[model samples]
Target: MNIKFSGVLVGMVAVFAATSASASPRPDAGHYEWRAGTQAPGPRAPLAVARRVWVPAAIAMTDADVCQSMMTAKSGAMACCASHSS
Candidate 1:
């Protein structure tokens, strides 16, 4: 019985040590490769254009206009600009 218990304990310790060793994050986990002349393939172009155009337009727009637009788009539930009146 003692030999059997010792064998089980040793097996559990070995498994635990193996798992703990592999649980650590790799050193190059955050590294990314950026290649030249390669555009990111997605809806990123429309979003980028919108950011360059829409952001400045939105910033220049009145607070009331922005709040009304948000309310209309989001079913009249505007928690962010609720205090502003159009």
Candidate 2:
């Protein structure tokens, strides 16, 4: 009787999952309005790490190429310059 009860429970769970999957919410349709006068938001810049992380802050220098190299060294391959800025 335990085996039979387990089989019924499994069947019920399967049916419930299938029904829930079918009843999933649909994506939003085009019903919103955009105001003409409002200005669009400016592009966001990527997160900046402190210069000290890339190089010693007390070096008393400001060099773009050196900074880029230091950034790449600290962050490895994940480090990249902004394409728009270049």
TM-score of each predicted structure versus truth: 0.31, 0.31
C-alpha root-mean-square deviation, candidate 1: 14.8
Q: Write the per-residue lDDT of candidate 2 for residues 1-86, one digit (tens) a residue.
A: 99999999999999999999888664232233433333445567334322321222232344567556644434354234343132
Candidate 1 lDDT for residue 86: 43
List, residue by residue over 1-77, the lDDT tens digit for candidate 1: 99999999999999999999888776434444433443445975433222121111123344766656653435545
Candidate 1 structure lDDT: 0.55
True-vs-predicted CA distance for residue 13, candidate 1, Å: 0.3
- What is the overall TM-score of model 1 with all chains considered together? 0.31
TM-score of model 2 (CA atoms): 0.31
Give, for candidate 2, the lowest lDDT window spanning 10 residues: 49-58
Looking at model 1, report the run of 10 residues with the lowest lDDT sum.
Answer: 49-58
Error of 1 at 58 (Å): 38
